[model samples]
Target chain A: MPISLPDLENAIRTAIPVAHLEIEDQSNGCGENYAIVVVSDAFEGKTTLARHRFINEVLKNEIAEMHAFSQKTFTPKQYEAHLQKST
Target chain B: MFRAAFRSSILSTRPSALLTSSPSSFSKSLLIARRNLTQEAKEKILDAVNATPVVLFMKGTPDQPQCGFSRAAIQILDMQGVPPEKLKTFNVLEDPELRSSIKEFSDWPTIPQLYVNGEFVGGCDILLGMHQSGELESLLEKNGVLPPIEGEATKSSS
Candidate 1:
């Protein structure tokens, strides 16, 4: 089943201490595809691969049901630096 | 589907006395057998990854990707100037065994996985992030998988 954006967002929030989260539904209205940016202190000491794996583990069930799931993760400090650079 | 059939065939072939004596041990042995099968698949995957400097296990060919993520990964590699000669792609959709085995082999849950010098690189999101940060270019160059710079040889000669 297609998971709603809010439901997915809530799931992530419940699983991790999220600093910032953005979930964009890329599958039009189907909810099968999502592009998410997650900022969490839980990812502080992890490599990119590790961080992605952590999130992947957390959303295992949801991801199994979805067709596509794209994620970008950052620690709070990295997210701040990224924001500064982007702006 | 096929896995279930295969499992049933294996179970059927086992002597009924053993199956009745210790069902738990029988299942444990079955698990070990399955693990050995995966080990064989892992070796084959290792060979494939080491076959080229840049190996991409994607859903389809670079020219015609079936998934958006796979297409994006191909584009990133192209943008990074990964030489076609140095890169080898395996379409996971073509091989059912490979489709499942690659995931277990990499401990990664997704497709369009890139391997440089037999090392696992992240999927599309990571590739895009690295591409934007200019890390992908340096990585390809460092691996010697990218084409030579246009004017470097002539510049040195001059």
Candidate 2:
């Protein structure tokens, strides 16, 4: 009756073909809380708030059953910059 | 005999009252405070923030902002003459605990927080407004560092 991390990851991947994605189960295995980082060109022209809205729209169904969701959405360019810096 | 009976009843009820509270419930506040942190983790985070004048808790670092807000935040600060080296950023993308703890620390639900003197100065919107009004310059002035604003070329465009 609860959504798993893989299920949440699938939902995000289905909605947006992101270059990179990380979903952390912050609910202490309670299946109610999640934190996600998604990188894609889909967010290129969007504002932060808009990107968040896009995710909310895509996950509207799962959200109803979820207790807390923390998200970080980035464009490909930004993700590339991040990747370069870390290395 | 009545006095002895009363003494026995009083002594018996005291142990039951104490037994009903578990060790956790007895130290509820301490437990709640410890729920999200190990003492060392909290100290490390606090130390990191305090050591850096401008701290950003974002999805990624300055060179790589993992979120639109994070990118915008870094860009805005850079545009204001606060270079990447002048800032200390934490990538919440890497650490889930730091991400949630930061939100709890600042009492602000948003990321890309700006801290000067280990105090929260607000997020992207506040930074943008301060940069435009030249208030950011004044704050930097008080800190004994003055740098020219970098967005002179795009000042009127926005």
Candidate 3:
């Protein structure tokens, strides 16, 4: 069975307790691929490697079944800057 | 592929087959039998990692990145103003064994894995984030991988 978007968010939120999340299903309803943008205090003071490792650890089971999983993680401040830049 | 590498290492080390009659050469078959593929792959992977400060095991070489993520990674390193000589990329697509075994070596189930000074950095997405935050540059400096960039160079020297 293909993994669902809610399932992906649920897994990340369970692990991270994220302040915000934006998930895009890039698999066109196949639910096999996704791109995620996560913002949370959990990322503060963490290196990119550590952050990715944490998310990977959290979604290990789900990710094993996924064909493509790409993500960009941000601390609250970084997310704010990214938001401001986008606007 | 492991066998191929071992064979090439044997050939390169002993260019003169006539003068080279070492017991080690005779024992190569035994070594091959005793040594598992995973162990050999790990050794090769480590060798590659240690070969350069920034090693990217990607789908293709820097000049012709086959995938979008690999291309993105090349661009990130480029943005850091790193010299091309300092970046060594192994095309995993050329060797199926290296491709699959690299995932096991890094414990990362993805292509386009980046290694800095024998340590695994995260993949392209992580790299992009690090680049944007200026963390990758600092990490390069911390690891003694790259020389400090323009403004930081003067500060460090002064």
Candidate 4:
């Protein structure tokens, strides 16, 4: 069963309380794949692996059912720099 | 043609010593063995992780990755000049137990996991970031996995 995009987001939101979050359904119709970019203060001091691990820990059950998952996590400060650079 | 790093040795010591150690060690060994390949698979995975300079556990071989993320990891390694011959890869599809057990061992949730000098470096996304920042190349070279600087070779030889 493909996990709902909202369900995945809500789980992340509940855990990380991200200020900004975007989910791209990269499943190509399978519904089991996703690409996520999440920004939160919770990530303030965490490494990429630690940030991802936190999210993964929060969404453990959902992740097992996933086919492909990729994420880019950022702290609020780092996300601001990224936004500025992209702009 | 990179061969998956094979474990340098086997766990011929048996579980007897661990059994006598403590309940924690007993359960830990059991986690390593788990349900998939049992004793053999764990030992093989551990051996490869320990012996190889750089190891990737992915969905398919480097020349023919079965997944997109795995493909990305290969590209990053290539960009870093981490030659295929120097790398060892384990296709998780070959063993169901390994696929799941690896996540447990590394406390990582994804495939295309990279390990350097026996440390879990993270999966494809972290590797991509590391590659962009030139950290991956230095990581390899620092560990003596990558070849020495080119100019130094001529200087030393002369």
Candidate 5:
């Protein structure tokens, strides 16, 4: 019942208009654990907790099956700032 | 071995103590036939959350965290200057009931869940985000859970 990377990406895209998305498989080859960064306009005006809750709701089934899941979410504006700050 | 000891400890405690701790409205829904998590377990978790001002339901003790995320959480709290006396950690791995019940209780799927003043804060990712943003410092300060700044008090007195 391990979720494929494309399937997870598609699930997020279909649910929300993703501006940017990065998913890293942290569980070696088992595909259970994931570290993801998601950027979307949908996250605007929402607290970090609320954004995570929204993503959790979208991937509820996938998350339940996976062993561990970690995510960082941001609005487009924040993502832009984050990118500039990193570089 | 350890499981048996944990089980015996639960059995030794008065059943009334288990029943008396109020279960929140959210936990009542978990009572329905969906999962194996029990009402007694939820009540225990509720009590654990309120046991201290800063409660961390993690995979292991703060001194020796088993998971990377749990360790990172402990580090963040330490970096925030949260007093050890004000913090309490529950190793969910030690208790099967708590391991499952806490997820249902907080509506969060991950471990290393944090509670400030009995409110569900978030998991490691959220905590790390807050830590980097400087919001966690203010939040801890506002809640009065963090230790007082060293020089500020002395400076004001002088």
Candidate 6:
């Protein structure tokens, strides 16, 4: 019953109905804990912390159950930068 | 004995007066002192987390919480059967640098952070949802922790 990586993903997916989303479990400290690169127009007007907060709000329950989530809530442009950096 | 006492007094007073006497040194030294405190706080948090099996970096202590989220987290733990002895919490509201640095350290930009077995766990809402679904019980079981109650766990903090 412990929160799993997929459960965290499902929470974010449900919280932000964005165009794209990727959840990574970065518990290993090798960028393997948990990273969610979310693409949402909802991030347009929000500051970095605000965007993070939005994700936090969405995953409030999951956060309490799971551990170590590093989120990059992004607009389309920011998501694009993220894609480029990863590639 | 008089000379020893005088030297000790001078040593303590000398450092205390520098900041009060000079405005520039005051600000600069204050900045340095703040930085040292920040470093020390981070170390303390890490050590505490590493030492304790279950730890929470929360907005207030378990007995008296300051924020709704923190209060909710404590409630969830109580409902989920997490005993008082197994839990250790740090009040983030008391330390600004710790509040900010914890975000950076965990890359988890919120309070009420939970750690199980020296690993980072998510914040409040996540904990509640897990509790509801019974996932919390299993996690505690895996860690050799016993759950508090089976039914009648329907109490909310606020």
Report the number of the highest-lDDT candidate.
5
Per-candidate iRMSD = 14.0, 20.0, 19.8, 12.2, 12.8, 17.9
Tell me, what's the RMSD of every candidate?
10.8, 16.5, 14.6, 11.7, 11.7, 18.8
What tens digits encode model 4's per-residue C-alpha lDDT throughout A9-72? 8777655467899998987878888889998876665667666766665566677789888888
- Candidate 4 per-residue lDDT, tens place, B35-71, comes to 2435676677788898878899999888899998999
Q: Measured by TM-score, how close is model 5 to the native structure?
A: 0.80
Order by lDDT, highest first: 5, 1, 3, 4, 2, 6
Q: Compared with the true structure, what per-residue lDDT tens digits does model 3 show for residues A1-87?
A: 899888878776655557899999998888878888889776777666666765665565677788788988888898898889999
Q: State the TM-score for model 1.
A: 0.76
**Which of the two, 1 or 3, has more lDDT?**
1
Q: Write one digit per residue (lDDT tens) for candidate 5, span B1-158.
A: 89755642343312221222132312322232224567788778778888899999899899999999999999999988888889999999998778888888887888989999889999999999888877787678778897556765212332
What is the C-alpha lDDT profile of model 6 across A1-87, one tens digit per residue? 455667666665654457787777655633324657778765676555455555654565566555455566678987787679779
Per-residue accuracy of model 1 over B112-132 as CA lDDT, tens digit each: 899999999888888888888
Model 4 / residue A29 / CA error / Å: 3.9
TM-score of candidate 3 on Cα atoms, chains taken together: 0.74
* DockQ score of each predicted structure, in the order shown: 0.18, 0.03, 0.09, 0.14, 0.17, 0.02
Candidate 3 vs candidate 6: which has greater DockQ? 3
Q: What's the C-alpha lDDT at position B81 in model 1? A: 72
Which candidate leads the pack in TM-score? 5
Model 6 DockQ class: incorrect
Off by over 4 Å in 5: B1-37, B147-158
The parts of candidate 3 lying over 4 Å away from their true place are B1-37, B142-145, B153-158
DockQ of 2: 0.03
Q: For model 6, what is the alpha-carbon lDDT of residue A8?
A: 66
Tens digit of per-residue lDDT, candidate 6, span B46-146: 78888877888888788899876789888888877677788888888897877877765665656778888876666665576467657667777677667
What is the docking quality class of candidate 2? Answer: incorrect
Q: Write the per-residue lDDT of candidate 3 for residues B55-131, one digit (tens) a residue.
A: 99898888899988899999899888777778888899999999888877776768889999898988988888778
For all candidates in order, the CA lDDT equals 0.76, 0.64, 0.75, 0.74, 0.78, 0.64
Q: Which ranges in model 6 have alpha carbons more than 4 Å from their true place?
A: A1-87, B1-42, B147-158
